[model samples]
Target: MIGKHLFSVEAKHEFVRLPHFGPFLTATAAGQAVDSLLARFDGLSIRMHVLASNQPDGVEAKEQECAYQLECACSEKSPLSVVEPLARAGDLPCAEEALRIANDHGVKACEIGYLKVDEGFLLLHVHMVTADLQKAMTATRWRRRELLGRPEKGEVVIMTTPIPMLANS
Candidate 1:
């Protein structure tokens, strides 16, 4: 299941500042940055959401609220260089391509983030309406491979639901 606590205090601030640093080229780079935040802050809560740059205005508004709800304290921004090597390796799809595929598959938004607090395995949370669940799941499966590059055996968790439905749950 997707954790209700998606971001640590530090991670929230980092995400809020990510845009100023520049666009993350790939999900792997973003994930690596998230991992770094967790390590640096001893963050127990962390999550990564992948959404299209051109989302509808309504969706964008809700996302801003969501970010606010997940706020935390940290001023240092993660350097893009930490993850640039993996991003330049060319093994994963660029953020734009991944977002395009997800949008085409009816995924309103998706998240790749840490799962168990102690285990440190990754979890993928796919958000979409019930009508789009199937296609969204397929897109999420593709994303799993892209983000994790063969996730550790028995360490994968996939969760799905509409974002509104997840707000209080």
Candidate 2:
């Protein structure tokens, strides 16, 4: 069993409320926000969530405040691996393959980023919710049975965040 201490890197980002249309973060501003965050926390695995608002129906709220929350963490001793970036247009196959490889190796978590430079956003896909390190360790152990020759296939939980492409990139 992997030690829980191996995944103890907790540096989370505060929620950033920006104008958004519907529940999607497809706007250029959303992309910029994500890019800025990635730059601020270099080398750390960042997971972002689009927080839902509780506004009343038909309120006609202009400049609706949409909170983009980010959860970031990383550790040198962690076993989690980030798959290579793939094109956004056709990344399903690549993501599936990555998940398969992770399951085969008994990896409890996986990260896959889709580069959509033309669309101005980088789609980040993670196999777990919240960057909680302890949960990862527990899940890993539960999946890796001692009596069983091989670990059971871990759940493929996908959490995605769209990061904006840098101006130079």
Candidate 3:
């Protein structure tokens, strides 16, 4: 919940095709950015879509509609953008190696999630979705520790406070 409303990214296989971390995060981040954009441009009527109009890609101009949409992904939302991450930057991408890269980068310390609003900063959800549901459970423990730093006994409610860094900086 980073903005005035819940805007969403309608991902095609192109974005969520897995193993490719930067693309996945960038695509997902784009959705999150759009949601935030909606909040910023609340009064205007925005016609939004995934920006796919060409076989190689057709959503070029629409990517620039917002400030946070990341220049790279928006510029080449078509076939050319496939090789790299346009917005969100992280450890190098592997062919469907998002989980491995994430773990290596520091799973216990940080995992990515969709951005949510927190204080004056944005939020993120970095859980890896797997058919092995048990694996997803770690997000709980990791989030608790990273956010609250090990609550003492009897501690129940936890709140998150994000420290803002420029997007993709």
Candidate 4:
């Protein structure tokens, strides 16, 4: 099984100018990128979510988008993260998808927050709670069998990633 460690994430902006479309595109994209990265974590589930004030105009569309991203993240089997270059490839749909899923699960409920930005980077946040840390470690191992009905043996990797968005910026 993967190692056991408290995982938490809070993003930071690097201050790079985003495309002319707007900060929504930039911020949302970064959030999605975080969801993708989180998906890599073994058995790492989205415990909660929070909608940004700048989110989409329509509520229905936004819910669909959030659900999708969280689904992707739920499917992961490894701890996820983005290096300097990879972080820039954030996706908007991913954020929307994750949001929906988090909302549906009602596990990691929503809360007000902000992303930390510096230079050109942005941070999205997730607060995960585990009753049993060992259980969480074991959970990652069963993912393959639970979802795919397949079994394998290997060391489950532990994870520690900052939130999708930053906080206290």
Candidate 5:
């Protein structure tokens, strides 16, 4: 389970409608897309969200906060400030695609969640939301493996030292 303390950043989103991806993407394609997109940000990692405030309904017009995990890759590094510019970059196709999808769905706003501490990453409940979440998550996971190297599986393993503390002291 991902500890709640892991999410130290509460990103603010300013959007007007919903955004969606094109046809469902294969894991390889999704990973490549995210890798290409991340280069724009100099390979910094971050979590981003795109939300659509519930539309007006009933006489009182109560506002309901709708949470959506927009189809995008993320990392347990970098800040929203760093990720936002790349997202808003004029020549970025991913950002434009995001806007186009949101326009098509009539989204309300977008939020970009980022990491505030240097901690081992955890995959959130992106699975509960959309297939796109998996696509993006898989892409980021693969990317992480590519850069940091993955642990090899073995029948027997040795723990030569005490477990280190994961949280701040």
Candidate 6:
């Protein structure tokens, strides 16, 4: 079994209400006010629900170009900041074959979020959570290194320890 640490990170940002239109709603004073609530958030949030082991099957040749997908294993909960580095990785297909492949690889759902400060869009918050905690931590460390443009000493906090699994009879 995998560890439950589920690494995560978060930062704060200055926010301004932006206009939005939903299927059953339009931009209005009340809507803008509601949008302003997002200002309370420093950055957008995202979660990885399914990690596909392989692409969906039965895709026609004509659809193959569109099939070059990756972020399907992920879910985005808010609009991304223009300056944010991480983008939608794509979503996992609902096809049975895809699900089977994901299962074979022991894939599990995960989540990510961002935070930026009000000044010049400096990212103030960023967070990621996954059953694959090592991969997530590596990515976070890489991001920090990129921001600093050099190698830096750092450590990821392990929130939970993994339980030892007994051998199967």
Q: How do the residues 1-169 of candidate 1 rate in per-residue lDDT, one tens digit apiece? A: 2222222222333111222211233455456556654553432355555544443435435545434332221223311110100111122334564455445434432332222324332222322222232343454455445657543322222121112111122
TM-score of 6: 0.19
* 3-67: candidate 5 lDDT, tens digit per residue: 11111112221210112221112334334434543543332343332323232233122111111
Weakest lDDT window of 10 consecutive positions for candidate 1? 78-87
Candidate 5: global Cα-lDDT? 0.25
lDDT value, residue 112 of candidate 6: 21
Q: Ten consecutive residues with minimal summed lDDT in candidate 4?
A: 14-23
> Which stretches of model 5 miss by more than 4 angstroms?
1-62, 65-133, 147-169
Ranking by TM-score: 4, 1, 2, 6, 3, 5
* Candidate 4 ranges beyond 4 A from true positions: 1-89, 92-128, 149-157, 165-169
- Residue-level lDDT of model 2, residues 1-169, one tens digit each, is 2111111112242221122222322334445455554554344344444444444343223223233233221222323322222324433334455566445444432444434555553433333333443464444344334325634333322222433222212
lDDT of each: 0.33, 0.35, 0.30, 0.33, 0.25, 0.28
Q: What is the C-alpha lDDT profile of model 4 across 20-107, one tens digit per residue?
A: 1112233454456456545443333332223344334564454445444334333433233321111221333244544554454342
Q: Given candidate 3, what's the lDDT at residue 152?
A: 35
Top candidate when judged by lDDT against the true structure: 2
Q: Worst 10-residue stretch by lDDT in candidate 6?
A: 160-169
Clashing pairs in 1: 9-72
TM-score of each: 0.22, 0.21, 0.18, 0.22, 0.17, 0.19
Q: Give the TM-score of candidate 4.
A: 0.22
Instruction: Tell me how far the alpha carbon of residue 121 in candidate 1 is from the true structure, in angstroms, after superposition.
Output: 40
User: What does candidate 6's lDDT look like per residue over 17-71, in tens digits?
Assistant: 1222111111232233334333433353422122222333432431332121111
- Per model, state how many residue pairs clash: 1, 0, 13, 53, 12, 22
Task: Give model 3's TM-score versus the native structure.
Answer: 0.18
Q: Candidate 2's error at 110, in angstroms?
A: 14
